[model samples]
Target: MGGNATVAVEATTNRPSSASIVQTLGGGSGIDTSALVQSLVDAQFESRNAALAKREETLTAQISAAATHKSNITGFSTALSTLSRSGNLATQPTSSNSGIVNVTRLSGAVLTDVNARVEVRQLAAAQTASTAPVTDKAAPVGQGTLTLTFGTASVADGAMSAFMPGAGASVDIIIDASNSSLQGIAAAINARNAGVTASILTDSAGSRLVIKGGSGEARAFTLEATETPGEEGLSALNIGIGASGTTIGSAAADAIVAIDGVAIKRDSNTIADLVPGVKLDLVSAQIGVPVNIGKTLPTNALLQAVSDFVDTYNEVFAALNKDLDPVTGSLKQDIAAKALKRQLQQLTLAPLASGAGGAPTTLSQIGVRTNRDGSITLDSTALSRALVNSPDAVEKMFAAPSGAATTGNGLAAALGAIAAEAANTTRGLGASEISYTKAKSDIATDKTDALAKADALRTRMTRQFASMDAKVAAYKSTQTFIENQVKAWNSQD
Candidate 1:
C-alpha cells in the first residue's frame, strides 16, 4: 500500500452533475422544496387574482349605490302622495250656525267661494194616522188583508181633498193568526218595506196602532182593510174614500227653502242637488233667518306641506348628485341614475296649472326656489302673499294625489311617473343592480377557476420536486461511502 491513498467517485453516467444536484436540492442549506413549489404556483396567477378581486369590490359597491339611489327617489314620491291625501290642498268650509245647518265640502269636489245665505222655512212633513187606544197591547187586533195604495193627493187647508192613484200594484198587509196582535202587525208592516212604517205607541192609558208614510205629496198613501167574518177589529185601521168610521189624515208636503228670494221645494230637508257642490244639512226651522256658509283656508296645513316638500325634495336632490357623480360614485356609469338629476330639475320647474293673469301658476311663483347646489329652499313670505292674493290660484298650482288608488294629479303624478320609470327592472336602476350583482358572481367564478389552476400547478411541481429530493439523498449516501473508504485506505497505508 502507498503511504497516502485517496479515491474520488465521478459516477455521472445518466444523471446530473454533482454541482447541479447541490444547486437543485440544497440538502444541508435549509432550502424547502414544498415552499418553493407553492411560490411558483402563486407567481403564475397573482396578477390575474388581484385583478378579479378588484373587479368584485367595484361591482359590489355599484350594486349598493344603485339600490340607495332608487330608495331615495321612492321615498320622496311616497311622501308627496301622503301629503296630497291629507286634504291640506283643499278648501275647508265653515258654517255660521252649526245648529241650524252644517256645511262640508265633498272629497274631489271643486268648491267655489260661496258665502250663500240659506234659509229653511219649513221642514218636510209626512202623512201620519193613529188608531184609537186599546185596552191591551198584545191582544189580537184582527185577521185581514190590509191593502195600501200610493197616490198624488190634493190638500185644502191642511186636509186631504182629492186623490189620483199612481200607476203600480197595491201593496198588501197580511194580518193572519201569526201576526194578529198590535205588536205583531207592526212587525209585519216593517218587514214589507211598502213605503210606510207601523208601530204600536203605548202610554199610561193604553196602546195605539200608528202608521206613517214617507214625506212629500206623492208619498201619501190610503189603507183599505177587508176583515174576516168574525174579526171586525181590522176595520178600525181603514182610512180611504169608502171608510165607514176611519177618517183620512192630513196631506204630506215637501220642504220649502229660499235662496235669493226664490222658493225651492224638495222631498227631503238635506238639500244637495239644488247647489252644485254645496250640501245644506238642515237641523231646525228658521222661517226667515239665514245662516251663512263660507269658504275657509287651511293656512297651517298648507304651510306644513310646503315645509315638508322642501325637506323631502332636498334629500332626493342630494342623493341624485352623489349617485350620479362623474368620478367617485359607484353608480357613476349608470344611465338611469344619471337621468334622475335632469328629471328632478324638470319636475320642480314645470307648471302644475294655468292660473289667472296675475295669479301664481307654478311652484317657483309661490317661492319654492332652487339653490346653487341643486337643492331647493322655501320662501314662506312669498307663498303667504300668493295665498292671500289668490287662494284659488294657489290651490290649483299644487294638485295632490286623489282617487281610490291615490294617484297624484300634477306634481305628485309627475314625480311618481319618473320614479316608477327609473326603478323599472328591465332597463333602469333595477337593471343596473342586477348587472352589477351578476358581474360580481362572474368574478367569484373566475377567482375559483384561477385558484384551481394554481393548485394544479402546485401539485405538478410538488411531484417533480419530490423525485429530485429522493435523488439528492441517494447521491449524498454514495458520496459518504466513497469518502469513508478513502480514509480507511490511508490508515491501511
Candidate 2:
C-alpha cells in the first residue's frame, strides 16, 4: 500500500470518530486512546464505587437479619402469652357419664374438687298444643285478637290457671275471608311473636294447627280469642283446656333435677343458678341414677404448657446469641437484641407473684432450670411433682396479674413486655430496623448517583479522546503530505 493511502471518514457533529482517527494516526500518535481513558476513569472512581456497593450489600443483609430477629421475638411473646393462661392449670369438668349428660365449664367458673349427685328427673319441655285435623290446613281459622297469658294451664280444665300478669300480653292478628284455614291461622299466630310460635302439623289424620309456647313453666300460655265481631272469631281453634279442640300436646313443664338429694326445679333443662359455677345440662331423664360432676386434676396439661414455653424461650435465646454473620445470623452486635436477651434471661430468675394455689415462689422451684448454653431445660419429674403438689403457685407465677387473658404481672408478662419493647414498630428495636431501612435507602441512592457519575465520566472521556484522535489524525495527514512532497522533489533532482 502507498505511504499516504486516502481513507474516507464519516461526518461528525460533536467530535470525529475515535476509531477512524486512531487507525489513521496509528503508532505516529504514540497513544492507545481508549485504554488510557478507561484506565484514568477506573483509577479515579472504581474504588469508591466498589466501596459503595459493599456498603449497600451489608445494609441489605442487616435489614434481613433485623426482620428475622423481630419475627422470633414476636413468636416468643405469643408463646409466653399462651403459657400464662388460667385455663391451662384450671380444673376441667368431666362427667363419668358423658353419654347421659354433656358437661362444659362456664366462663369465670372456679371449680372445686367436690362430688355432686345430679339426677335429671325430667327435661323441661315447651307447651305445645295442636288443633284437630281440618279438611284443608291452608283454610283460614278466622282472624282475631289472640290473647296470650303465661302461667300454669290445664288442658283438662280448659282454662289458664296461675296467671302471670307481666308475662301475659295480647297480639291482634288479621284473619280475613282470604285466610280462614288452619295454615293461615298458624301463620297469623307466628307473625304476632306474642310469646308463642305456630306451625301446621301434617299427618295421615290431616293438617292440625300445632302451637308451641316458649320453653319452661313460665312460657306456658293459654290462647283465648276475641275476634272482630263481623269477622270469623278464633273460638273454633281453641286448644285451651279441652274446650272443644283436641289437645295433641301437654302444657310446658319445669325440669326437675335433684342435686345431693335436694330437689331443684328450673324452667329450662340448662341449670346454671342451681350450682354456683356449675351448669347442669339435662340430656335425658335418669331419675334414680346419680351422675357425679366435679373437677379432675389438671397437672399434665400445665406441665406441657410449661415445656412448650421453655422450647420457645430457647429458640429466642439461641437466635439472639447466634454469631453475627451474613450467612448465619444478623443480630449478634445488635443492641436491642442483646438487651432483650438479657431481660428475658433475667425474667426466669426474677421473683414472681404467687397465684391462688400458692405452691412455689420461683420457676426454678417448679424445676425449670437454666442450662449452661443459655438455653432453658425442664426437669420433667420435678415439674410434675411441683404441679401435683402446688399447681396454683406454679400457675400464678406464670399467670398475668389479673389472672385473665390480657397482659400484666408474671414471669410471662415480664418477658412479654421485653419482647414487645424489642419488636414494637414504634419505639424499641423497631427503631433499629427503621434506621437500617433508612441506611439501605441512602446506600441505594448513593450507588445510583455514583453510577451516574461514572457514566458521565465515561461520556466525557469518550468525547475528549475523539477530539484528540481527530487532532492527531489531522497532524499525521499534514506530515504525510509534506514528506511525500520532499521525496518527490528528491527523486526529480
lDDT tens digits, residue span 1-493, model 1: 2222222223422345444432455453346876787788888888898899889889988888888878888888877766665667777777788888777676555566576777888777788766777889789989999899888776554345577888967999889998899899889888999998988888987888788889886788778788988887888777555554444455677888787667888887677865556777778779888877788776677777778888988877787787677888777788888777777876656766556577766778888898888888989999888788877766754456454331224567677777787789987788888888998989988988888888888777766775677566656756776687789879999
Best by lDDT: 1
In candidate 1, position 90 carries an lDDT of 70
Candidates' C-alpha lDDT: 0.75, 0.69
Q: Against the hidden true structure, what lDDT does model 1 obtain?
A: 0.75
Instruction: Give candidate 1's TM-score.
Output: 0.69
Tens digits of lDDT, candidate 2, 272-380: 7766656778899887988888777667777777888788888777766773433566665667766776777776667675445555776777888988777888899
Lowest summed lDDT across 10 adjacent residues in model 2 is found at 7-16
Cα TM-score of candidate 2: 0.81
Candidate 1 displacement at residue 322 in angstroms: 2.1
In model 1, the runs with Cα more than 4 Å from the true position are 1-30, 37-50, 122-255, 267-270, 401-409, 447-458, 474-493
Q: What are the C-alpha RMSDs, in order, of all predicted structures?
A: 8.0, 4.9
Task: Extract clashing residue pairs from model 1.
Answer: none
Using TM-score as the measure, the top candidate is 2
Q: Any runs in candidate 2 off by more than 4 Å, and if so which?
A: 1-32, 76-89, 99-101, 155-168, 174-194, 246-248, 323-329, 350-358, 396-419, 429-431
